[model samples]
Target: MRIVSFGFQTWGRKTLQALIDSEHEVVLAVTHPASAQSYKAIWADSVEELAKEHGIPVHLTERADAATIDLVKQAEPDVIVVNSWYTWMPPELYQLPPFGTLNLHDSLLPKFTGFSPVLWALISGAPEFGLTVHRMDEQLDTGDILVQRSLPIGPTATGTELVEAGMALIPGALHEALSVLEAGTANWRPQDKTARTYFHKRSDRDSRIDLSWSAVDLERFVRALSEPYPRAFSYYRGERIEILAAEVSTVRYGGTTGRVVVQEGGGAVVCGPDPIRGDNHGLVITRVRAADGTEHSGAEFFTRGGYLTDVPE
Candidate 1:
């Protein structure tokens, strides 16, 4: 098949590699322009590099400018496969290929249709999450599904883990979807609009932790934002402390919300409620960043703690 690919990040690199391995003719590749200021440079690789290695034409543009469209027209590709491209596709550009454009979405379509689907899934405590390859429409991710596959989100899985898992599934899904398109026997199921859910981009403030929330909820929040991104945090004693790791403990410790009840075994039990069990629960914080920006175990923070007062405004 004569193919053109549009994507950014490691996911784009992996998909381009898959096309090469499958012996498909990838005539061109498109990706977002690199930025030096943002942390995205660490997480994403240049798609242009991959395209050049394959001797394919590459377009690194924030938008599909006239020149990019001309390049696609020159390639005369039968299909355009998009994976994790940051920009929205204009209809004219998407329809340039004869077989139409297919997009790889991180979540099962009609469910998570916007930015940061995997992160939202982790934050919501969803046990299962998946990917979908679908026909690109004017509406975001509201397209006919070409293929779909589900994967388990282990209790400890973070946003990074989920993204890696989803990336692993892309090659197989792309191949299957492409084969169907080539055969003109592509079987697509219409998405259920009534069941669709949407999410907006997460803000910096979204990472803040609320002490009033249940231990279960807080635990999920901490796990959701751990490591790669900023960890969930709260203000204590006029200082910001990042809660890096925590667990819902069985120990019964009574104190006001955000109060430190006990410190033992490199862990500290803090007061919070349990929404699931409908009782007061203790948060076993294992790791944290101190007010002075020093990283330390929960036990260390507990030993130095005075009274954990109310959340600062």
Candidate 2:
């Protein structure tokens, strides 16, 4: 089938590559211009370059403008496929093709519908995260499902790892969706919006550590914001420090939340909620990075034994 692709960053590039390798024809590619945002830079693969290398038509735009719509209309694709297109897509654009638009979102539909889905899923403690190819609708990711693929989230899985795993699913899932579409046997399933969970884009503020959370949650937070993405961070001694590696402490200690109580597990035991009861598992910060860009073991860095506050002390 003839296809038109809308995407951005590494996710977009991978989707375009899969479409190029498939039996379908990718007639046009629409992608956003480069971004300077921290998150956007992490997976900074060039969709425009790949499309151009293959001699497919490429249009660089932040969103689907009238001219982009006209370009798609002229391309006259049989179907439209989108991934990581960071803007609202009007119905006139998505519904232009006969088969409508097939969006490849990096999460299971009816959950993790918006930006940074893999990160949000890991932070939310979901056992599994996956990709879904669904028909586009008026709402964001509230479309009918055509194909779905999932991967188990291990206890030690990081956000980067889960993202790569999800990207690997694109080839199989896209191929399956296209096959069904070609055979006219696509079994589209309606999403239960009641189970839908949408997450906003991640920003610097989202990485700030909140000591009120349980140690397990904080540990997961650190892993969710693992390298390439912003590390979970807090302030200590009026300086910013990024938590690069952490885990739940095996011991419980009582103290005010954020207090650097004791050393344990080759790291510093930082108190969380319910400290007075002495039943809380403190967060064991194993590794950290200072504002000056130096890395240090948590135990070595927190030798002064202060508190990790969300704001400067």
lDDT of each: 0.79, 0.90
TM-score of each: 0.90, 0.98
Predicted candidate 2 versus true structure: per-residue lDDT over 216-303, tens digit per residue: 8889999999778988999988999999999888887787778885467445555665689989988889898999999988888888
* Per-residue lDDT of model 1, residues 1-313, tens digit only: 9999998888788888888887679888888877753335535777878889878878888878888888899899999999878776788889888888999888988888897788888888888889899999899999899999889989877777787898889888888888888888999999999999898877667888766676777788888886667678777667777888888877555555666645545454455654334356667788889777788878777775544444653
Model 1 quality (TM-score)? 0.90
As a whole number from 0 to 100, the lDDT of residue 297 in candidate 2 is: 86
lDDT of 2 at 126: 95
